[model samples]
Structure formats: C-alpha cells, structure tokens
Target: MTFEWGDLFAGRISGMAASEIRELLKLIDRPEIISFAGGIPDPDLFPSAAMARAYEKIFQSNAGAGGALQYTISEGYTPLREWILGYMEGKGVRLGLDEVLVTSGSQQALDFIGKLLIGPGDLVAVTKPTYLGALQAFSPYEPRYVSIAMDDEGPVLADLEAALAARPKFLYLVPDFQNPNGVTVSADRREAIVALCAAAGVAIVEDAAYAELRYDGEALPSLAAIDAARNGGRPATVIHCGSFSKTVVPALRVGWVSAPRDVVNRLVLMKQAADLHTSTINQMVLHDVVSQIFEPHVKRLRVAYKERRDAMLAALDAHMPKGVTWTRPQGGMFVWIELAPGRCGVALLERAIKEANVAFVPGAAFFADRSGANTLRLSFSATKPDRIREGVRRIAGLLETVEA
Candidate 1:
C-alpha cells in the first residue's frame, strides 16, 4: 500500500496557505521579468563593507572567543537589549530592559505574539487591507478577524469603536507606511486609536517595520509612544514590533518586541520553546554595525528608495489611462494601485507575467476579508529607476488590454 503523507500533519496546518508573494517571486526570477511583487530592499543599498567590518571585529573580540558561539538567554543578548531600549527611547518610546524580547525577526515576533495571545476563535481586529505576513503569522493560532474600515488618515473612528465592542484579543496596526497600501496614520489618529483601545481594555500591536524609512513629510509619533505617554511613561497596553530588515540588514534577521514586563516574560517563555534564541553572533555583529554606521546607512537607503519611488510614480502618471488610481506615499517602498471597475488583479496577474514580463502582488491577498479584487500592490524597492519606469509602462499596457 502507498503511504498517505497528508494524514500525519497537525490540524492547524489546514489553515496555512503558501504565501502568494513567495510563489510569485519564483516566476519573476528570470532575467527578463520586472517584478514589483516583493517588498524587498535593494541589494545595492546593503552596507556590505560595514557589515564585513562588523563581522571581522566581532570574531576578533573577546565576545567572539566561544561566547557568541554558545547558546544565549531567550530574552536576548544583554547589551543588545539595552541598545534596543536606548533606540526605543530615541523614538519617544520609553522601554526598560525587562520589557523587550529579541526575536529572529519581526516575523518571528509576530508568531510569538500569536502564541502568547491568540485563542481559538478569538477576534483579531485589523485594518481592512492588512499586511499579508501578519495574517499568516496569526492564522495557525486560529483567530477570527474583524477588519475595520480605513480612510486616508487611518482607521475610521466609528468603525474602530464598533470593532472594539467585540473586545478583540488585540488590534494589529501597521501605521507607518503600511506594507501594501503605503499610507501612514496621521498623528491625531494614532493618539486617538491608542486611547480608544486602552479604554476598551484591548491590546495594541504596533508594527513599526517601516517607521524609520521616511523620505518625505514630518515624522509622526508612534502608537507605542502615544500609549506610553497616556500611561505615565509606562508602555502597558501596546506591544511594538520593530525590525532592522528595512533600515539595516534583512539577512541578519534581527528584530525585537517591546511590551509590558509580564507580557515580555510570557513571550520570552514562548520564544524559548520556539528557537532557544535568536543567533547570538548575528545580534553581536548587528550591535557592532549599528554602533559604527547606522545613521549613514539609513540615510543612504532613504535617498536611493526615494528616487525609485519617484520613478515609479512618474511612470504611473505618464502611462496610466483614466480610471486608474494609486496612492502617493510619502516614504517606504510600495505604491498601491486600483484598476478600472470590474477588473480583477488576480486575473490580471497571469497575463501581466506572461505578456508584459512584469509581476505584482494581487491586493486581495492583503485584505483580511479577501475583498480588494480590483487592486494590486507594486513595490519599487528592488528594481532600478529605469527598469521601474519600463515595468510600469508594461503593466499600463496590459491594463489597456483588460476589459472593463
């Protein structure tokens, strides 16, 4: 008898689906394809020399004398956690060492959060079109979703209030240049949202992955910072997820979460069961790199990505016909586009790849309710300016062939 491989899997695996972006990335790997499907940073902007020096310095130092090679505390490297606390302070979020836990990446942090907080059938509040990765992270834990309506400013207050009535397990927000939408929550809404959640006894999970990538507009206060101020400098009601993937290096996979002390302890226990700890060598090297060249490296990324964003926007304006619209983000790497009425982004994706040699993520994947069928997300982070322009032109040409 043939073995049935599918029967052995856990029940939770049934809810998991392969990432659409990951699957799409495979097809767009050919040299001729122009892919705007991935929210990847440009390789050119990586601080390779600085990173090399950091690794060299780490291996040459006393910390590397078998110390970094050894297993570390689940809470993370002491000095690195301290450094993260200081970093958060600079962002207006006052966090103590006991309140932070370092994870392999912000993605891991999301999973740990789900493990600690989510219960089967618990309602998880989110924006209508949320980050796909977050949905994936929480799906295994089996949480119901309540997607709040959003406008240009951010989540609408009325919708948020109604969602809060359900007493969700937590509210997940990507307020700074959100992944697929590329829109920032206004300062007023940030504060209001925190206060509203606090009043309803709901936790706020603030994903600040792209908070530091601003190329235009003044920086807005983080939801974590606002929550801290509201609670007299104690961040009790919000958990802030941060990453070096965008600002520093993604391959290092260093990310952190700041929460209340009790929450941190719980998350640390969950993390210990997950991977023992994030790589100690990577943390040490990252700390050294940030100590040496963080500011300059981030500044370099801002300049390069801004150019790419401008190129993509210019192409969209020049090539797109009437009835097509997209967001003009102040910073970050994506431009969310809406096709003419009755056009489906998922349907267009296959034709776009085969005919135009261009690829983008279908916007429906980002929606918790899976409803944005006419929209798509284009990323300008990976491609060069000229290629970005050409890719947009190709996509625009394909749109012309799409019937309304």
Candidate 2:
C-alpha cells in the first residue's frame, strides 16, 4: 500500500538541478536584506496604467473579448507576429511573418531550441561564463558542453574555431549585454562568428533577451543580423530568441523565435505539444500595449537602469578593496565581479547573508564547467541607488575581512 514516487520518476528528472538564484530568493525575503542576486526589472517602471488600458479596451466589445479569450493558432496571433517581424527588420534582422513563432516567454524558446537541436551526448558550444538559465534549460537533454573562452569584445575567434571543429548541435550566444557578464559581442566579431559558423554548417541560438537594454556605447550588430546579411536576408543559420519581459512587461509572458521556416515549423509542433499556445488574452493585450507605447516605455527603462548601473559602478570603485575587480558593463542588469585569489564566492555568500546582510549569485552556477569559484554576479536592476551603494559597501567590507 506504500507509494514510492521517487522510484517512478523519469531518468531526465535526475539531471535537473534547482536554480541557485531561485533558491536564494526564498531565503532573502526579509525586508532588511539588500539583495543583488536576482536579474529582475524594477517594478516601478512597469507600464501598469497602459496595460490596464489595453486590457479594458480588449474587453470593451464582444468581438474583441471573444477573440482574445478564445484559443488561437499554435503559430501565435498573426498581428503580433507581423509586428515582431517589422521590429526585427528595423533592427537589421529581417524576418518574414512565417519565420516567427511566439512562445510563453523566451525561456520557452530556449527549451524548444534545446528540444529541437540537442540529443544525449551531443556537443553544444557556449561561452565560458554564459547565462545560467541556458545551462539549466539544456541540462535535462544530457548534452555535453564545449565552453569557448571570451575576451572584452566577445568569444575568442581562435577558441571558437577549435570548438566549431566539434560540430556542436548549435552555438548559444547572448550577444548583447549578456546575462551575468554584461558583455556585448562587437560588430566585427559578430560577422566573423557568423561566417565561421555558416561555413562549418553549424547553427546558432541567439538569445537576445537583454539586447534592447543597453545603457552606454554604440550598438553592435546582432549575430542574427550578420547571419541574415551573409545569407542574403534569410536567417537560415540562426534561431534568434527574443523576449518582451526585459523591455516591455515581464508578467505578460510574451517572447518569440525568429528562424528559418523549417525550424519554425518544428518549434511550433513542440510548442503545441507543450502548452497548446501562449495565453490568448495575454498575447492580445501585449500586442495592443506594444503597438501604442513600446518606444517610450523602453526609453524610460533604459534611463532608469542606466542610473542604477552607474550607482553600482561608482559604489564599487569607492568601496571595494584592491584586487577585487568587476566588469564595467555598457548596459544590462548585472555586473560580474572577481574576488582576490583564494577567495570563494560560495563561502562569501553564506557569510554575506549572515554577517553583511547582502546577497549575490556565486559565479560557479553560470559556468557549464563549474569553474569561476572566485567570481559573483550582482544585479542592480531592482534595488534603489541608495541600497545599491550600501550593498556594495557591505560586500566590500566583507572582502576586506577576507583579505585580512
């Protein structure tokens, strides 16, 4: 009569690991803690009023209410897909309406891309300290990872060429203001990567979630754009994933993939089996809100996040002891910090919560190889400037203690 649930679980379940940031979020709920662990957008910038108006407008008429509330095509709402096409084209990555497949969020697109491309023991090329969520998304598929080294501009071309020799299932890149690291691939490097990958018959999964969140420096051409240019405006070699969560509203859960027609079709099949489709009402409302106020809203976010980033950078400079270095991100929510040699970020995190009352994600979680024990990622998006200053100061104090 006893139930043994663990014995009945699938083999893939064993490969899954909890996200460290998600776990840390549960323990840092105390109002007194100055948490820098989550890459969350500031709630103050959400377009609540505009979203409300869009929702009200959608329900104002019978035709509007019926269409929005009803289940739609698995490919996604047509108008939204068309709008995204125009948006991508404007950014230099030309996409037809058929090339776009809307998903619950770009997170879902990651999962679908993994499902489409990765198989057990297949190799995937990734940046050394890439996005943590990508590693988590691909882990259940049981793929091996080849981490290419990165420099200030982006992945080292020589290292990338060596990795490409393995003929990975695909190369995953977070091109603009990459998560955790906040480094953007330069335009020249983007072209080189595209040419090399295309020549080698490899595909690229371009996660552009934070591409639109730049705070400084001139914008670089996206890998998708360069790929399109190389392929004569057809994105045959790239599966570009983008999300509205960072630039628009996170709660809306709207994101999309722009790829070749065949890839789009395959992803649609996977998407249909996964969730039928993204929420009908949410998609409609997102399309409405974006049509009316996207530019102004994103501009507001850029200004706000830029200020927070500046504050964090200044605080780090003023407080951090010698040998503690960090990246000066051009834009994006995170700043990657490296502690002095022999320092452990995981150990520092434990003491940070208990003694310093500040929290951050250890860098090990972001590395597919589980290296970078002396590094950490600090997110400056959700906290106020004053809290950012205090948090960095507290962290700097902890580092000094470690040095002593």
Candidate 3:
C-alpha cells in the first residue's frame, strides 16, 4: 500500500519551474572546465580572517551583552540597520533606519517581494533577458511575465511604458550591472523608468546587488534614490534590495531591503515568520566587520576584479569569432554575448565541453520565453586573468567550429 506523493501537493507546485542556471551549475564543478556561468564573487576576496577576528570581538565583549545567539527583533540588529542607513546616506541615498529591513540575502528580498505582491496571473514586467533567479523566485506565485526591450544603456522606456500599460504588479530590474547582461541603467533612463512606473501606479523592485562595483565612468544614482526624490518627501512604489554577497561576503548572508516604512514593517513581519530573523550572531559580527574593516576589503576586490574584467574583454576582442558580439561591462562579474542568428547557445555547450573545455550560461535561461537561443553570459569575477584569456580562446575555437 503505497501513498501517492502527488496527492499531498498544492496545484501551484505543478507549474513551479526549476532554475536552469542552477541546473547548469551541476556541470561546472570540474577543474578542467573554465566556467563563465555562475554569478559568484571571487572566493579569495572574502575576508574570512577579518570575519574571524570580528566574531571573536563580538563574543568576548558583546555576546551576552545583547544575547547575540538569542533571537532578537525580526527587524534585525539595530546597529547594523543604523550602519546601513548611514552608509546609504554617504552614497547619496536618503533613508531612515525604520525603512530598512535586514534580509538573509538580497535574494531573499526577491522572495519576500514575490511573497507580498505577486498573485496568480498577475503581470510582471522584466527585461527581455532578465535575471533567471528572479523568474525562479516568482514562479511559484505564477505571474504572467511581460518582457520589455533592453539596449546597451538599459531597458527602453517606451517598451517599459507599454509593459506598464498592461498594469503589471511590479517591474523587477537589476539596474546596476544587471545579471547576465552586465548593463547599468543610465541616469536619464533611470529617471524615465521611475517616472513612468510611478505615474502608472506600478511598483519597481530594484535589485542593485552589483551597484558598488563600477569599474569605470561615473556611478549612476540608485532607482531607490530617484524614486524617493520623485515621490514627494517619501519613497514610494520602489522596493529596493541590496546585499553584501557581491560587495563583501556571500556566506554570511547579509542583505537588506529599503522601502517605505509601512512596507518594511510588513516585510519584517513576514521575515519573523520566515526564519525568525537572519542570524543575530552573524549580524553582530558583520556590524563590527563592515564598520571597522569592510572598505579595504572592497578596495582589494575592485583592483583584482577590474583586471579580470579587462582580461575577458581583451580576450573576447582577440578571440571570439566574427558576428559574435558581447557587452564590455564597466564593472560587475558578467558579460552578455550573442551568437549569430540561428545559433543555439545550449546546443553549442556539448561541443564547448568536449572540445573547448569551457562552460557558459545559455542566455535563453535568462529570458522568460526562453527565446534568446543565441545568447550567453560570461562571469569574470571568479576566474583569474590568464584563465579568462585561455577560456575565451577555447570558446572562440568552439564557435569557429560550430559556425564552420
């Protein structure tokens, strides 16, 4: 007498889709494979030693001072929230501590936003090739995704307005060094999108995970900042998510949401239910570390990653086959590429693995309709410069064979 597993599930589970990027990662573990697939930051850049020292400091003096191991407010550690508020102000984003809610990672903010706003069949506006993780995050709620046109500068405002006209529940944007594409929204475009969304009564989920890593050119203002400025004296219609994962350390899982005070209160309530708040012990350690030592760590990352980004760009220019075009990202980890029409990035992966011995994320996974068959994403953050050059050369060789 066997019990059926299908009988125990909700109908929503049937439509739930798996993340292709996560699936692709299974093949990326081999040392022989030069993978440009993951959005992972450099492991070497993590300040493990600094973190250790900070943890010691927290325990020696402050562990029982606030019961670091004991559960605290679901709103997260106040000192950390205060630090983030101060930091945002330093970056020109005006916000109060009450408007920020500490999340487990920026990714969890995505999950929470989806949890709060998305309902069945709701419209969600996204770039044609947006972040796959967002799609995975929101899939369970079963929103109908609408893709807006994107260019080198960012999402086209006309297309975005058209998408908004459909009355989307919200628009999710990576805006700063967008995942997979590695494009940042220009100041003008950012203003246009913000104004359009605000007027149309559409919410904007600004995922600025890679905001701090700009390699060249002036830093662009955050959508949250622009939204705050536009919405009278308070932030409105913008739910901003940021993380230390890309900027500092991923393992510690420190991320945050900055939204209107009321919205943040709701998120905090939801957070209390989710995990009873992100680890307080880790939060205390981070408060100490970021305040005392994070700047130098970020500086080292900038120097090392800039060289790797440049190496990938140089290699692509020298090695990629004709008709294969790629974005030269100013900062952040990825570069988006497009093969000549009629080519399939996933189909080419078999050859890439057996012949070139390199791996890349097929761009189709980044699209809702899975139509960018000719596209691919390369990550320069984790790989060293020499390996980047070698990987690009091998990928080019594979492309030549496929094109031939």
Candidate 4:
C-alpha cells in the first residue's frame, strides 16, 4: 500500500512545533481533570438559539437570491465590511469600508499577510513570548523571526528599535491583553512604539483578537488607532487584524483586516484565489446576528468573563506556591506563569496531568527559540470561576506534594 510521494512534507512547517495547548487539552478532557488550556470561550456565551434564528432568517430572506448559499465575492459581504468599519470607527480607527477585507478567520488574515509580504529570510519581529498561532501561521512562510524582548508593560523600546534598525518588514504585536502573557502595552509604550515604527519605516501587524474583552481600566486605544492618530493623511503602515471568534462564535469565522486601500485590494485578490471567499451563508448569518443580537451578548460575555478572570487571579494568589508568579490580566483568555527558574512547563505538565489531574499549555510552544521552558500559559476563557479555582487549587496542591 505504499505510494511514492515527493518531499513536500520534508520542508519545515511554519510555527508547527508540538502544540502544548492541544496536547494538554487532550489530557484535560478526562472526567477527573481540570483544563486551563485552549483560549476558547465558554459555550454558554454563544447565542445558539439566536444564531439559529439568524440562520433561518437569512435563508428566508435570501433563498430566492440563491439563499446566500452560493459563492460570494472574495472581498466579503459589503454590508458586513461596512458594519465592521462602523464598529472600528467607534474604537477610534477611522477607516472607509474599502479598507476592510474579511477572511475565514483572523488566523487566515495572518496567513494571507505572511503569503503576501513574507519571503524566505524576510525579517519579522515578534514579542519574546508571543501568540503560538501567529508563529504557526507565519512559520510556513519561512521568514527569519526576530524575538524582541518584552516587559510587563509590553515590548522593550530599545530592543524594538534594535530589531527595527535592521529594517524588518513588520513587527507583530498582540497589544491588548496579549495572548499568552496577558499584558497590555501601556499608553506610553504604545505611543513610543508607534513613533519609533513611524521613524524606522517598519510596518506593524497589530493583532487585537482580544480587544473587546477588557474588564477594567479605561479602554486603551488600539495600535491601529494610534497609527491613524500619528500617521493619518498618509499611507498607513499598520495592518490591523481582528476577529469575532472571541466576541462571538469561533465557528462562524468572521475576521477582518483594516489596512490601506491598496493593501486591501491586494489581500482581496489573494483571498479571491485562496478560498474564493468566506462562506456566504455564514457571512449572511453573521450580518443578521451582529446587527440584531451580537453586541448585547458581548456585554454579557464581558460581565461573565471578568468574574472568571477575577476568580483565576484570586485562585493563583491563594493557591500557587511561593516564587511562582503569573500575570494579572485585565481582560483576555490567558495568564502567563513563570514557574520557579529551571522548572520546565513541559516536564511539569506530565506530573500535572497524571498526578494532579490538571492541565495547562506549556510555554515552549509560544516561543520561537524554545527558551521559555519554565513558562506556562493558562487560559481562563473556557473554564468557569468555580472550575478555575478548583483547577488552581489542585495544581497548587500538586506543586507542594511534588516538593515534599
């Protein structure tokens, strides 16, 4: 049964290292285990009934118009793009509808950007501990990655400048409640980064996938907003990618990138060739859900998730042993934990699963160089408050037992 195949699989896979998140998630599925893996939202938050209604409504209205079951333009449904632009305008990123391009998801937007701009050996700067998915999406392109150092407030300026001095094509950032680290760039840091990137002529790829999940403090302005604030009246150097996966249902896969009109045109062309378009049915359903039901549901998500975030933080504070530190995120799904030095999250994960019956993503998967062995990413988005507390308690007990 052996069939001869070429070395297509021989090439390096972009960011395709063993995914600790998924691996741990498998273990966490056991009835006895508590999972702090996968940055997924709770199913309770999904407006399943409303979504069904929206789906039915779309079919009823458009069945005669081919039921919107047919193929759509690669640029996406015009009304959805217009709605997204309107939503962004409220967030301070003033842009025309033409600048928005929808994709299957925000992940696809990253892949499309990598395909369009990144070639082998092209320099792309990323935060020291960054989004695992970003690394995955961009890795296949084989771009030479430069991991810029970061702090609690966000990317270190000197390091960013040093990386940008080499004239990288773009710098990737998860500005608000960042994926693994759960750190938001301070206002000053945001301003400094924008100013520096502007001077260096380095484009910034801003991933605001968790932007709407803010739980405390005033809403920080997005890097895209900062770009417009600083670089308005010129061709924009910021590529803003975002998704409803966090705010709404991930399965719907509605995400968009707001760039200059020229950039949008190119992405539209690329997208046309990629999948022809995102699903027309999904887009139509989303339009209906978004216009009628999505926003209010998001407000509910905020209230519920904030409580969960608080619970996780409190559990970590009360239960984790000394010398173990974690991020106190105001919003978003993850909390980056730094275990006592020399403790590899990967190595500890086995004990955590088999002994403690708990799981969290090992930090190594998020690093480009596999240097963060002592780090771990715990996602609070999926688990409930009681379970979050229970999970931390169980893991904390394991740490103590392992020590003894």
Winning model by TM-score: 2
TM-score for each of the candidates? 0.98, 0.98, 0.97, 0.95
Q: Indicate the worst ten consecutive residues by lDDT in candidate 2.
A: 23-32
* Deviation from native of the Cα of residue 136 in model 2, angstroms: 1.0
1 or 3, which is superior by TM-score?
Answer: 1
Better of 1 and 4 by lDDT: 1
Compose the digit string of candidate 3's lDDT tens values, residues 1-404. 99999999987787578776677677767888898877888888888887888777766866454688888888889999999988877665778888999999988999899989999999999998999889888888888999998999899878987899899999999998899899988899999998899899999999989988888988888888888777654678788898999887888899999998888988988898899899998888888889887778787888999999999999999998899999988888899999999998988877888887888888898888879999999998989899999999999988888778
In terms of TM-score, how similar is model 4 to the real structure?
A: 0.95
Worst 10 residues of 4 by lDDT: 6-15
Go through the candidates in order and give the C-alpha RMSD of each one to the true structure: 1.3, 1.0, 1.5, 1.8
The TM-score that candidate 3 achieves is: 0.97
Query: In order, how many clashes per candidate?
Result: 0, 0, 0, 2
Ranking by lDDT: 2, 1, 3, 4
TM-score of 1: 0.98
- Please give the CA lDDT of all the candidate structures: 0.91, 0.91, 0.87, 0.86
Cα lDDT tens digits, model 2, 1-404, are: 99999999878777689999998777557888999998988888999998899999998999999999999999899989989999999888877788999999999999999988898999999998999989988988989999998888899999999999999989999988888888889888898998999999999999999988988888788888888887778798999999999888788899999999999999999999999999999998899889999999998999999999999999999999999999999998999998888889999999999998999999999999999999999999999999999999999999889888
User: What lDDT score goes with residue 110 in model 3?
Assistant: 90
Please estimate how well model 2 matches the true structure, expressed as its whole-model Cα lDDT. 0.91
User: Model 1, range 30-128, lDDT digits (tens) per residue?
Assistant: 989999998989887888898888778767867675887889999998998998988889877887888999999999999999988998899999998
